[model samples]
Target chain A: MSPSDFLIIPFDDWVNFLVRDWLVPNFRPIFRAMQVPISMVLKGLDDFFAFVPMVVTTLVFALLAFKYAGRGMVIFTILGFAFIDMIGLWPETMTTLSMILTSVLFCTIIGVPVGILAARSDLTWKIARPVLDIMQTIPSFVYLVPIVMLFGVGMAPGIIATIIFALSPIIRLTNLGIRNVRTDLIEASTAFGSTPMQMLFELQLPLAMRTILAGLNQTLMLALSMVVITALIGAGGLGLTVNTGLGRLDVGGATAGGVGIIILAIVLDRITQGLGEQKKVETTSLRQTLISLFKPGAPAPAHAGKAA
Target chain B: MTSKISVKNVFKIFGDKPGHALDMLKSGQSKNDIFEATGQTIGVQNAAFDVKEGQIFVVMGLSGSGKSTLVRMLNGLIRPTSGEILIDGDDIASCSPAKLREIRRQKIAMVFQHFALFPHRTIAENAAYGLKVKGVSSDERRERALLALEQVGLSSWADSLPADLSGGMQQRVGLARALATDPHVLLMDEPFGALDPLIRKEMQEELLVLQRTLKKTIVFITHDLNEALMLGDRIAIMKDGEIVQVGSAQDIVSQPANDYVAAFVADIDRGRVFTAATVAIEPSTLQLADDTAGDAVRTMEEENRSAVYVLDGEDIAGVVTYQQAAAADRDSGTSDVPIADVLITDFPTADRDTQLADLYAPASSGLPIAMTDADNRLIGVIEPEAVFAQLSADPATPDTEPQVEADQRELAPTA
Candidate 1:
């Protein structure tokens, strides 16, 4: 036994064997089952983006940005999309946008309820808190390995990795936001005879909307960053553009992809943040006011409808 | 009638092992002793009282004295570690969730010290919240909310956000919120405690005036004894989670149950609290304006007094001194002359609720202060000495028999 061999343990081999045989084989069926919903959402988003011309999509986003973030964002979004198209990354940009949106859509659908559960029950919070910590603390790249082994190398696997990477922030913040809703308000609501569901919808969620939106923003940003990284394992999009540009040493193309990603990141971040800001204003939107008239029992759906 | 709200042997021990803490408390451990031994806080201890219908029943104590806790229990906001809270004959402590919600909606409503108005909502919306929870139609609830806001003089500001209002206005919104529910009972946990002195006084007056017409059972919590004295029809004083005493304002003020209660009541301004009504006594003798001056003098002599009130039936005409009656009699040269001409109307008159502080000028003018009813009928009279005696802090003094003994005796049986 040489010096190097003398200190060695079979930890790596054990982990490798666990993943290759037991873990992968046992969880393959579960992963395969997960593919159904994932593909459905992915395909829906892909086709939706494909049907809308790049110009139309840019204008729609610009209109949304104008509603939420104001004039500066509108201009930025319009110019940014036109630049991405001029650089011939329009198709790839759409794929990336679809992937990021799908990832966030799934994250929001899953994260919020789980966050609500965590906020409600201390036992659920106790179990969830550490799992979220582990998911967040593990390097983003580490998620790709199990994702690749289980789902194989492709856009779906990349998306699964992005979903996992982006999942923690929304859950953690939703839990925090709900928990942070003033105890006095909750007590007042309860004292006034709000049912638990009523309390959550009427008192807790409305009060917690801003914080939860902040969480969505964080989750969206994480998904975008992860999507770029996920391009490594044959996932197509802007990440592929950058990775290919890097391989061919074409700085200009890579820089263009980087600029597109940056613009998307800033635009999304600003829009989500602005949605939270709009909630702070005393005025309710005309649509919300109408919704309120129609759905009297529902909580104010201004933020919830948008996030969902 | 059944009590509007009744708390029976209620104890709230705050900790994981309240049941165990309660057992220890029942087995003779003091609150502090229990806390030291078991790390459990006794939020309320063996508290029992009945708030009558249409009464403002105040629970008063310093901070951390469980006054808030005791009031919270009325609406089942804080469940007692053991014992029962009955609201209009339904024991809320044992109520199921659905039943509790029904009781909270239809029977008892609460107002918080911090206002607890939702910042995102308009004041009208906050006021209508209870009604909304009760499944009232939007139009009806909004109407009721506006009506309640009108009661609190806040209807005009209903559309404004709660944060835009002053502290006092916000509390009015809280009060209006509670009022809109039209519940049988209102639980106010230091609802006006956060207001400034001037605003607090105004709110107290407003609440009293509102109570006159609304007639809802109110359980108010406050640390300010002056507020308790001013607002409470009956007040219960709590200390260290235990109710030390419970009685009317006069009873608690004049005959404190113990030194702790005495100390609490000591700083209270008695002149403002003890009204002309509380201090007034029956006149020793009376004379009619139509009576002969001879008869008036004779009655005055018999009563060993200088003056007599000239009564025109239940109505008070004036006060006449012996000299005035005799002089009128001599001048007219007849005992048959009516005493009405000799009657003097120079003394001060006040309504029954007039503060003793206001009565001082007239009371010290060497004439007894004449107290009148709404119809200007003489109810009773308050002398400078009587006012002094009633205002005195020493309860053991013999001269203040009517002031001290009457209230104590009335309360003794119930206490």
Candidate 2:
């Protein structure tokens, strides 16, 4: 027939047989067990976001934005949440928020330690580099079927796929940040007799914090972008709304969902980016911020006043 | 003084398999040869020296000369590939990591060239870092950190962040961090190499002033020869990972070990490097009890000198010039006038250890500056001629005959 016909090896069939006959049957239980933690956390966050009154949630988020991102962010956050509420997408938005939060939480829990390990050992980095490359570069939909076969189609599995997609940046950046600490600073710490743990916590971690926060912001953005894709696997959120609207070819509904996602993304991005850029010395603890918020004559937070 | 830190035949070869490089090196191959053959860079080679207690032992070299690498080994920051590095007789090279860390925490501290104060940390926090590593209580560490900051004249900046301070002040924080531990020895690796010249000079003076009281056994690394001569009680000149010579400022200036060392010392200001003790000639004297103005005049004439010193027992009464002695001899109308009566007691004097540069004013009187001991006894005399001779001597000239003749003339004045 053709030259190409002679070279065909049915690699797709091999992968299919490997997943269906070997991996799914033997490792399904382990995969299910892995989903349990994600399910619990996702359920808890989803319930909390849903149960909280819209006004109170809005106020709390706005206060946080004000404290970290300044008054401009505060105004945007309040108006953005109000607009989402006006569109009757509050519940869906809550579910999406929970999904993004759960994914980020899990990615940080797994990614940061792996990143630290990679930074410490050349062998670990060599092994991780290629795996992270595959996780990041492969089309997000390619692994959807495997994730579905392993963990089944649901919110937790959708979030799991999202985690796989979003985990690379945090790990890569964390490794880079820790490795890039000034050698003289490292030497100074060592010369002062800092033990390995002390050096990590006192010198390395504190110094690498800004870089790590930037990584976190990147991870958050990736997680947000994955929402619509994850919705294909039965994830309920603004992503679901958009998917349903598109199915019926309702342009207005899809645009509303798109607007809501953009609003949420911008608020979250600005807050986290501001957090990354905030001067470490000038930043007050949350407890202090709360105290200052309620204290008389302390109308604005210390950082806000300084910024103005 | 007892040796506080002793480094003996230590070598540090950087590569995956240093043993091969070591074997090659032991076979008498040069560092360049070993590197070319095996791809291993020799950081320090066969380095051996003792840093006596309270002495500033400066290891001076140009960049890539391994002076930094050698200083790092003293604090166990870089372990030697072979041989022993002993701090108070304990072999740090062979010690366990835990023991090495313990020794570093209690016995030694280091100041970096870049003033490696943590950017996120406050001045106090950076200063307290050493004590924090040692598990000191928070309040106590803060108190001690403040005290150390006070030593560096940065007590008021304790609460300020490191970025808020100037470069010199940041280095002071680095010094304060080192001093907070109050360790027995301080290792400074080109600590002022990054500062501006004016700030470097100020920091050097401040460190010397601090060393006077702290008396911490210091091993200072610098590429600047003037810095080495100004601050070092003894200097070790390193070249290509090996110490070319180790001696006091006077010794290294007057007698460089090899051509490389001579070239290195050639550009140094010899007027400041050579002290009065180094250039001083033995004094020509007339005894206060037995010798008279006529004896002074006869001695000056016989020696072809401008002046003679009058000694009352062991201590100098003053100097008697040729004109003064002859004038006294003529005015008295007799040869028995006491030498003290003609002695110019108001003549300028200097300590034997005073630098030749500092002896200029005393030498300007056109009389030999009487070099005295601690107890005011006349140990020697610094003639203007000898000062100029030593200052102007070309270090590149292989012929040392003029120096030898000058050395002989110093002895001949007293003979």
Candidate 3:
């Protein structure tokens, strides 16, 4: 016997028994309820991506990149989509996009409010900090077993696991951003008789937008990285393609799927980053940007269009 | 004048279980002793004062003296552990949160030390924030905000972000924000403390000018004694979480309540703090209608002075110097020449309330300065010697004894 045998606890067996005998039987309905929303969002986004024609999708994304991220991003988006289509990985890439989008949507809906609560109350932060640390630190594969056991091997469960893995940063950063607002500004708001709700929505949220966007960027990247690990549970996407290619030892196919994910990640990252990194002084509203885009003599859009 | 804000025996203890700390405080345990026992810091202790309507009541102290804490309690920003804060006779200290918020919105507004203009907002938006929190309509908010900005001379910068403005302009925006609400009371916590001395002086003057028309009851907090003297109608001086003295500038300078207040006022420029009336003496007069040039000279010699004011009834006819009276008597070859003919009428007269700082130019003429009442009758004379003596007296040393004796003598006749 090894030193490990000195205190044998049977922790793995306890977890296994807990999942198989108690949790799966008891919490199955609750888990199914959880999956319903994720599945509905994932299916809607997935079907929408599948329904749009390839050229129209490419042109629309290219136009968005041009409008938001400038000429360099527009050129890259168009060429990158064309390369993915040529390699016949467009459908798989679309499925992966939908998965990432769905994970982000649910993460935002849950994470932001939790973050705000944590920011407002010390007790909430005390409770949330440890859970967030665990979610961030645990290996993605360890939770896969329980997720598969509960929701059983599908796209929705994979996306659910992706959300769990990616949720921490958004919550942590949102809390930090609101907490970091200058004390003088907070006092000024309070001195002016702002209700707690008005303070949160009008002052705190607007001031913390850049930091929250950065958190969203981080969450999206984390969700994207979870794609292949999620594919182990039979989720369909470029991740499935990559896993299948790896199982067959087809290096060329695996490289093609890996390249497609990289291209899609780069496009998403650039667009979101551009949204956050606008000039702080002289911040133009979205309406202003839209108006300028359509204005006859607007210099930025004209220059961007010419460059494209 | 009605009391707009009345704070009675307010105390603020910062920590968990403030109730226990408050109990210790009420039982006469020292702040440090309670801190050692319970780890609770007393921020303000037994603070009480009444701020009259349209009065600038300045609370002045160095850092960590709890002046800031006392000011914050007035608006319910920091609730007091025990006591009453009555704003217009409504006890804000015991009011519910909703009622307190309503009070803050409609009745009171504050300007912060660092000018706390929202970084992301336009100047007009920052100015309109108080009105916005009060749920004013957008058009009226903008209109009033622009008007306030115009009052502070920054209406043209209304569309620009706070980052685009200088520190002085940002503070003006802070002032404009407070003004936009048209509050009954304004709480300013070192609003100009962050500015350089030049801008601070300009802002102080601007605030005084603004107050002439606005006449809002203002509680101004500052660490600088000179600023307190300049801007405060009445001042409360705080030290170690207690108010040591509260009085007008002249009262504090002339008779500080304790050593702490004395030391604080020691470095202040007394000329600006004291009025001409404070140094004035009862004038020796030769009646213009009855006395001659010889009598004027005789009176000056008797009084051991260079001049005697010649009064026509109660009003000053003019002043006659010994040289002018003697010359007039010699030229006319008669000791009975009229005092009016020898009277020199070009001398400057100061109002009784004129600051001694402004009396320097007239005092330089080597003649006694007349302190006149509002009806242009000479109530007293501020001799050049008295002006120099008062200005040069060092209050920080034992030598101030002679000055105190002189002050007593000056007050004797008036009393």
Candidate 4:
């Protein structure tokens, strides 16, 4: 082994001491203390806002459908939701979904800013890049060990594993997007007296968004793959069910859970992909229709409507 | 349009602490002294010129003349290390961010040779992007974008992606994008340098048409002599990061500012460049207007004419009748008949101080137009093919030899 690998041994030992010895024993008490009051606040809304699930889910699917393939998709998404309930898997499906949601949410919060920062600063990007490379290249199975030690083999462990696997795409794409902005366009923006901040938010970021969305798509896919792997650490969801059934050699149960994960993956993938595709098409077509619509005798192709 | 851009005593040096280098240079240090003191290379050296508004001002030179860098500074893309760029009496360095944005988004627009239309967007989308970014209402932006496309004659290609367009068409799209911003000034950096010959001509005409209609202030950069001549109202010839000369097209063509400018204009076929205004006309000495045909021939031998302007009083008429000249021989006791349909190239058709080398005897007369002075007097008559004859001597044109002595002038200059 190289000297670098030798140093990694003590680093692993330190991680074990902190996570396995200190965190597992004490972290839950600290987390529970924080959650108790928030749970009470949520308990008050739980009864009155039981329909919150239906409304939020509908809005999300509806907006996604409208943006992507259209209302045809919305009808199908609604039916998909109904099937989970009819199969008596509503609560379990929701639990699996929340886990996926938490993973993606945390990934975006951590990943996007890191991506943006890397895009702007060369030194920061150079430092952040190799770390992300390591995160992506390390075995997903290996990630479960540290998270299990720290977060103690539950949904949080599943979440942490998913985050590490999914975070790389966002940062890489964000860097590429910013770098690829046209020299003339950047100069034009600067000439306009756009402050450095204004240029970042208004010009550079918007232009980079399409690339960033592609990264997000990649991240979501990686997170979905890692979710099932994390189930071996005792996270209870479709993944945990699949893992449990496999342990007991229950083919019917395992197959059903596997099928359920596929269904969820397809739906989420389609909706997010649809939104990304729509944004790309919208920005692009707006520039093009300017000339196309003006063509004398070339009958306009429905220019009055939204690009979708 | 007025004086919109003035670059005064500008110097750009590439190195650490260019300010210190400039200060040292200003404090009696030579170029080599500065080089030794600061290890700096000068990008622009004491470049001073003003671009008049609504003029197609050309800055032309070989690579490293800093024309590209100069244009960048004009548009505030780069700040000068020393000296000032004044736009409408406002120094660019003094301008605020808001002011700069106002200038970039409103007053000026730029086109690049690479046709850097956004790869992701369609032609129309790329054209309308500036307007969209500037917060023009969608309807107005779309309307203006369409108008710009129509002006560039690319309305039919609105939906096409930039990648799909031909290089010439993509340059047009780049032009359309610049036009969409409704700019007061247009900055083009060799925008047609990459096209094939035929397409380059087409784009040159396209730009001429745009300038005619828009009357926008234009700053164009190019290294091609022919293109510089075809486009610039006033040209600044650059060499080694400094302008060698700045003058009108006529001045540059006729007098030439220096040996460099002379070398730049050399090898250009002057016969084609000169029009009928270059030639002279003398009244016909042969007075036998209506004499018998045999008598006209006798007068022709007596009064030798290169190209007799067969006149019908003060107003011009036609060439001498062959039969009249043939018959003049009998009246003059001469037996020879004059050749019919001889080309009238030497008469009033040639420019004053017309170099003897460019003159050629008429091979034929098909197309004819009169040259006039500022006073509207007929100087000479020239046919369309005369210019062609001079230019077609190109050894590259294997099919045409061009017998005129003028045709060989280009080869001798190089020799």
Winning model by DockQ = 2
TM-score of candidate 2 to 2 decimals:
0.92
Highest TM-score model number: 2
lDDT of 1 at B239: 90
Error of 3 at A30 (Å): 2.5
- Candidate 1: give its CA RMSD in angstroms: 5.8
Candidate 2 lDDT over A203-293, as tens digits, reads: 8788888888889999999999997789999999999999999999999999999999999999999988887888554766778779787
lDDT of 3 by residue, A54-95 (tens): 999999989878766888999999999999999999999999
Winner on DockQ between 1 and 2 is: 2
Q: Model 2 Cα displacement at B255 (Å)?
A: 0.9
Which order, best to worst by TM-score?
Answer: 2, 3, 1, 4
Where is model 3 chain A poorest over a 10-residue stretch in terms of lDDT? A299-308
Error of 4 at B95 (Å): 3.2
Off by over 4 Å in 2: A1-7, A280-308, B282-291, B299-304, B312-315, B398-415
Writing each residue's lDDT as its tens digit, candidate 4 over B158-213 gives: 87777667888888888988889888778898998988899999899889987988
lDDT of 1 by residue, A1-308 (tens): 59776687888799889998898988998887887788888889888898899878998889889889889999999998888889888888888999999999999999999999999999999999899889878987776777788888888888888888899999999999999999889889999999999899888999999999999999999999999999998798899999999999999989989988998888888999998888877456667888888987866744322110
| Backbone collisions counted per model | 0, 0, 0, 31
Judging by DockQ, tell me the better candidate of 1 and 3: 3
User: Model 2: per-residue lDDT, tens digit, B9-106?
Assistant: 89999999999999999889998899899999999989888888999989999999999889888888788999999999999999999999999899
Candidate 2 chain B, poorest ten consecutive residues by summed lDDT: B404-413
lDDT (Cα, tens digit) per residue for candidate 1, span B256-316: 7777777777777888777887877777545564578888888878877777788877777
Against the true structure, candidate 1 has what lDDT?
0.85
